[model samples]
Target chain A: MTPPETETETASGEGGETRTLYGSPEELPEPAREALGDLLLVLADTKRVLGIHYADWILGSPTLEAGIACSAMAQDEWGHGRILYAMLDDFGMDPERLEHERGPSEYRSSELLDEPTDSWPELLALNLLLDTALSVQIEAMRESRLEPLHHKVSKILDEERYHFEHARGWTARMASTDRGREATGEPFREAWRACLRWFGSEEDELASGLAAEGIVDAAPGELRRRWVMRVAPSVAEVEPHLVQETEDGWGSAVDPDWEGWEPRTRRLRDAPGPDDEAILSRVRGDRNRSLLGE
Target chain B: MSDRLVQIERSRPRGEGTMDWSGVAAATRGDRPDLDVPQWDEPAADLAEEARRALYEVPDPEYPISLVDLGLIYDVTADDASGRVEVTMTFTATACPCIDFIRWDVRERIREIPGVSEVSVETVWDPPWTADRITDRGRRLLNRAGVSV
Candidate 1:
């Protein structure tokens, strides 16, 4: 079979299939429009950074098919990045400048994008959990009033569902083998910790505003609950040894300082660092260039 | 007294982000006192072609194909005097992560083939590779497997 149209061979696979532009946005809700800029940036950052992570596995994968699968997903993330950037530009922001020139701190992506995956299980968890989380938001975006963003999300969500299925299925298979079960269980715990840091607290204005205006349809915290319900069943089947968290896992999204919790914003603008360029350069330098081509 | 002027720093593998030959060489060959180290007996003319030939000799080791046909070989060049060969290649993508081991495996195999000199294996990104870049042999194999390139 020919490789999927979305896949290609490159160091990063960041240069995947070219994005087709949907029409520009018309009049939008003021709050939604304002939140759209950072929302798109966050999505774009997830694509770009995740693409880098996928590239890191080149040549190091256990098998050829594994490599091909990762490359395909990496390209998908790159394509997703482009789609978000296009939507941003359609909404009146310059995607080219925003993407290539922005700093890491300026990125609105969740913390899951910042951390690197050291093993296949970690990568798998990111796909199953993190991407699944993003997919939840995308489902809501399917009905988004913003035309360009809505159509793009609808297309992307379809593709992303497949990605989630692959990961979930793999997680199921991993449960069969003792080594797979153990190897994955520990990493899943660590990944869950990382996931906890993903969606921001309930009081974040941007998240609240986006949800209030029906831009994202739901806040990340609300989306996370759904995400858990969606993934936990499949994942727990494989690794019954896994520990489950209660609703207190993330606590209430509406609470500003929900007891023993700290508020983390999903907005790239709130990340603890310089802008995208600074982050990208740092990641680039640390990036084991040869690894990218693997 | 040393009569030969060697630019110690420059000649000492000063490049950043690339592997250090000092360590690799030591680990691979230094401890093995009995291992036969290949030597160059001829002048380094047509070094690129020689390196290309050497690289072509390396089978995928994992897959049932040669690196050239598998599309793992990208660019190959040689420095006649230094006997140094710089090869650029790529795997399927960042996700096909086993490439590091493949690259190192290829490098080791190539280096052991009575190589005239050094080997620099790098991963280049410009002019991205596609299935179309695969050789006729690769295409035939793909066809046999019902895979369209």
Candidate 2:
């Protein structure tokens, strides 16, 4: 859906003459700068973890072609992670520390990617739902006031097009069979909850501030709605508990369980974030650390 | 920079009713003011030409075709005085497994050009690549290699 346009006055000079964009990260004002940092961390960290999971399936997917797609998608995620991390460098964050030194506790990734997919159908649900969740959030930045994102965001979105298609195709294929639908049910529910919940609530200041400052075109709730519209139809048949169709078309089947949700980490207060240091170890290239050279 | 916050332009106004894909399939998406603007800070045309010519000789790691023919070299800037060369390029795919290899190749090849002291290879994704970006030379070469255009 086309989002409501922010007025030029709030988004630009006092006269509201024209919308002027931040020429670079250097020009960002105080809180918007910090908010963009938080936003990028969430995106880059999620991509990093998602890439690791995709890498896990490269050799074991149901088909050789699926395996190849996994390899490509894994590379795409890592490549995107690298780009986002580089962008964070503008905020005085060190890429090396973020990628290598940080543990699972620091991750802003949705809990859905916190664990490995036990089955191919589960992975497809993640690809269809979680990936779209990330893509729509990125889409919110398509006209970011942060000028640097014009290129960076568009580039990342280009690579993700194939990811969405891959997910949509596989989910449709898997949804075709009763057995497949049964298998995908649990995973779809997991992703459905994660995508909606992780987007944070309308009350979340950081998500809304990013919009108020024009760093993102939409706030958290709108992005979640867009994500639901994108994935609801794909998961509807298999996951009755997670998708609803109304006269307005697609909407979440249930209210996201926002209890215990922490807006800062974008995780629940009670649940432990992914305790998998092993995945972090691989992403940091721990085994091959000896081989890394200047 | 002013501390005052400015609201951003919503990419699409409500009632436009189109999916906000940002014209993902379109050639270019939005403005980029910070990154290198080829036209604004161009190096000597002759030097840039030399850099372009050199890049044309560098083949993609997996393909025999030159980077120029593949439409991967977006812009080449050469400073005859400063001996600096910047090649702004993109890959056939973002996850081109050979991205690093290609970057190294572009850097090393451009470095070989006379008068170049520093080489920077930057990648951009706006105006995403399609078969349409392929040069006539790229088409002929790919056709010769038994790959359909």
Candidate 3:
């Protein structure tokens, strides 16, 4: 196949070698373009839901500062989602329709966020396990060969540093005591399994195809390793059996069960559960339809 | 700060109406310039400076210090030919509640300049805003405002 004549940006990669980057979505190979669009939709949808999940805990948090942090993180998620959704028009998708028209069966966020976190421990689990997974995945695209997105990815990663500190700080605090640890243990395990599976498995066509195209810097297994290494130090103490410290770095003791895993949506089901619809409705601004200028 | 210290690009013509976020790819650093637009020699750079000088008049809602001095304005460049000034900026935190007001304030302030009929404010998060981005003038202003930098 002949390369289409398109302006390709080049990134100064490690070791001083320059790698070609796709300047626009139209320039990408068919499979890679589809994979990237799918991946981005999943991420944007999850950020919107995750923002609400964070917002749910803002008022009742254990500390004022923690509640404030939740408020801030929630805003960041919505802002991030808007930026991503705005760019979907280039992928032949309508940004407004994607954000407003989707139903529960159409959302691409994880099942973990299918409902509001029931307790502080559950929210913390989503923070350390689920949020960190999203960050690590974004980190892999910091030098994405998809040129337009690489800088945007870096911007999102910079904003996420505080989120990690928030998660790590709260995780250590909760895991520090027997009572705190016991309350957080089950939630962490459930969250870990879901997030670990979110990266998909070795044979995932979408994950592997994107890797070959250099859209995401690392492959699925590598991304999972980064996710585990990121979450282990704070989360491992409480869920000792769930995480394993390797000779070199970190590992997960329980491998992901792929029975219900859906690659495109990165969830157990094809879309969010019915319980997730209420908040998803709010994300669509169903209540304030009259106020929206658009 | 490398050899490519100059990330400035000549702005292209646009409709003068509507005040929303605009594309920064042409004005952003390291992007290949749009071949169709004629490069502005020097007056373009000067117009951007004029826009920046104007921002000193707009104080942050919470603080008295100018937004320029506070380091919120990332990059300011103007196209004298098109009368458009593109300002790339960031907030101190994602949760800054004053962002909407700040953005409106920015557009209004830039429009006050004589050669600036169109204003574009693009917000970025990468290399997130830090105290180090604040200018020495900002420090003195902050000090005067009873806030230690």
* lDDT scores of the candidates, listed in order: 0.59, 0.73, 0.76
Enumerate residue pairs that collide in model 2.
Answer: A10-B7, A11-B6, A11-B7, B27-B127, B83-B117
User: Candidate 2 on A30-146: residue-level lDDT in tens?
Assistant: 677787888788888888888988888999998899999999899999888877887777788977678777777788877777776678987887788888888898988887877
Kindly indicate the candidate among 1 and 2 with the higher DockQ.
2
Model 2 chain A lDDT-worst window of ten: A1-10
Can you rank all candidates by TM-score, best first? Answer: 3, 2, 1
Candidate 2, true inter-chain contacts retained: 0.33
TM-scores for every candidate against the unseen true structure = 0.52, 0.83, 0.85
Q: Give the winner by TM-score: 1 or 2.
A: 2
Highest TM-score among the candidates is held by which one? Answer: 3
| Native contact fraction, candidates in order | 0.00, 0.33, 0.31
The model with the greatest lDDT is: 3
Candidate 1 DockQ, CA atoms: 0.02
The local lDDT score (0 to 100) that residue A129 gets in candidate 2 is 84
Compose the digit string of candidate 3's lDDT tens values, residues A127-232. Answer: 8888889988888888777666775776677788888999899988987889999999999988988998899999998789999888888889989998998888
